[model samples]
Target: MADAPQTMVIVGGGLAGAKAAETLRAEGFTGRVILLAEEREHPYERPPLSKGYLAGNSAREKVFVHDPTWYAANDVELHLGVTVDRIDRQAREVHLADDGVLGWSRLLLATGASPRTLDVPGAELGGIHYLRRLPDADRLRATLRTLGRENGTLLVVGAGWIGLEVAAAARAYGAEVTVVEPMATPLAVALGPELGRFFAQLHQDHGVRFHFGASVTSFEGQDGMVLAAHTDDGEEFPAHAVVVGIGAAPNTGLAAAAGLELATGPGEGGGVAVDGSLRTSDPLIHAAGDVASAEHPLFGRRFRVEHWANALNGGPAAARAMLGQEVVYDRVPYFFSDQYELGMEYSGYAAPGDYARVVLRGDAGRREFIAFWQADDGRVLAAMNVNIWDVTAPLQALIRSRRPVDPDRLADPGVPLTEL
Candidate 1:
């Protein structure tokens, strides 16, 4: 490409931003690259925040995506603890909090998301917390440390991924943990009720309690510290520490302010809607990671994924698009999680209620199984393997093939997925 942009600026110094910067230089782009991170530390992974970090299994330095010297060596100008106020799309500039500005030929909005806050009364109490940044995980680990040293109670609101991971960490640290969710099953929207109940049973076997179909109305405490949770049904639960993980709200303020088009209609999950090339409504602007609601060429619908693999792959795809190269972000979505002794990996794209049946291989009772979800059209929508290894490749292929499958063949351990 001749006369490429002079400068490429990436907003939000998370995994996506870091990868985008890496991809630019790797693609032979010699332009100035500035990666702005709101945090004072180097870009780091977020999954460990609840699993390894909070459980005292990961060291501090292990979380960083790269060493401090990597940025300087790669000529990637790194700015930490900087607040970007707005995107001046008209002038191709980013306004800083202190009224400074940086001109960019291309802009990538990797600005992730924030934890959804509970609207209940006494929400500001000290013992209640949310996990998003490294500091939040650090504080929760400290609380878990105290609980491990003695004994305490932890009330976790919402049964989403983060909530369940935190609950597993807290319980592992010797805390008596209780999780509350308005949904009858945890992750009902994602995994459906059958598998969700399997997870509920897993937690129960590990000594964790659950309050299903319950809503929190307020928190009661003394000394401005959360001590108890009050439910709408007039039930009082002891809560020495409260951690909320309802879900994440995408940070799309700058995109909205810049007049970038967003998703619309029922299937349009909200965010900056982008095409297969990851180009937003504004040609000069690109949105990746959690902030981008990019249309999936495979699913025939837009999907904004917030998993590690998406951020890892989408960043480079967006960078290629920014460089005037032809690229389609058609990679099947993938995600993995660890809870207690169970390690599960899932791949494919399926919105809520897209799958009609789940074909199970191996026994769910033995904690070693693969659940393959199929749509009404007989296509494999998604699949999850617990305590299974090295199977995501074929699982992804099955999804990409989009062919009808025999349930018996799908459930046979002797049958290789490729044959199906």
Candidate 2:
């Protein structure tokens, strides 16, 4: 019999893939590990692309997760700019786009997502952009620097995190920013209507115009440069540049083509199905980050969360599960967005039609408040706070520990979160 294979192959060098390799080494695997990255550069942090990086406040080197020496010294073979085109499950081989094949004893799929496209007319026009990879941010930064503040009329479509962050950056550059969203409020699906409204107000206060409940019907342009956008309400507005941030669809075509079981339904969003332990139907394969639909113990359902926290925490959890120890990948779903003068942070999980009661702590008028979502059983389901970081740690612990707190006490700002 052949000796058991010792090589491990990791596809996609995003945060999840890099962390998995680091975790494996930390666990004393000491085997041959290969990390395949489609990008030429090493794995770098992405959250800043839409924020500090876009504003040119963060240098490129500062965004990288680790130095090149770390990967070299750790004996991780990094394949930069090499795309994995096919996975042969039976053969235990990954076929690269460059006509190369890598054999492995175990495989991990950390292929992150790409930005969802706008199917509307004039999408191919110039002066239109989408923020995802490092290259995308570079293009946006160039545009911002060239346009400066006076001539900068940025039309941002969608009110998700990326869109909002870009808007914040544009406004900070003294650009006139306008955001269009089909929903009643920005981030309604994620932050709920009430908190979403607060976010809308926050942006409006920073001189950003928001077209709530508005959809872009088409874009009108000449010479491949977008000039204006027509709305479904029969309105037109001039725009110098356009950004589409409608959200993202998981890059799961490779997994789906390999016959991996995918979670289907409204919230799955085209992602691979994984159990509580973040294991796919094929035990040899594991997934993390935005591409993996993981089961949440607190929410009691499977969902895909596209957030920096999810990628940072879920990556390690999936790595642990892949190492033969079954571990529940449960972390209070957390996300933060810095836009204008307000810093928004949220913890726990909240789905549509889930919150039975919402308790407000602190003063919203003063721009410091905490909104708690409670289930019908009066248990806290999720919480959002504006400039209130003190409540997050306790609330996160409560959600993870499944501890019920008194709703009345939670509603009072004077009562310390520890009282729960």
The best candidate by TM-score is 1
lDDT of 2: 0.85
Per lDDT, the best of the predicted structures is 1
Give the alpha-carbon lDDT of every model: 0.91, 0.85
Q: Candidate 1 at 35: error in angstroms? A: 0.8
Total clashes, candidate 2?
0
- Total clashes, candidate 1? 0
True-vs-predicted CA distance for residue 231, candidate 1, Å: 0.9
Task: For model 2, give the 10-residue run with minimal summed lDDT.
Answer: 143-152
Estimated TM-score for each candidate: 0.98, 0.96
Per-residue lDDT of 1-420 in model 1, one digit per residue for the tens? Answer: 577558999998999999999999999999999999989989998999988998899898898888989999999999999999999998999998988799999999999988899998999999999999999999999998887677899999999899899989988889999998999998887798988999999999999999999999999999999999998778889988999999887898888988999876575658789999999999999999988898888888887888888889989999999999999999999999999999999898766778889899998999999999999988998999999889899998999999999898999999987788
lDDT string, candidate 2, 1-420, tens digits: 977648888888888888888888888887788999999989987888998889888898887878988999999999899988999999989998889988988778889899989999988899999999988999998887766655679999999888889988998887888999999999888878877888888889989899988899899999889999989998887888888999888889889988899989776656989889888889988888889998777778889988888888877787777778779887888988787777878898878788787789889998888888888877888888888776678878766666677788888877877667
- RMSD values for the candidates in order, in angstroms, are 1.4, 1.6
Residue 398 miss distance in model 2 (angstroms): 1.8
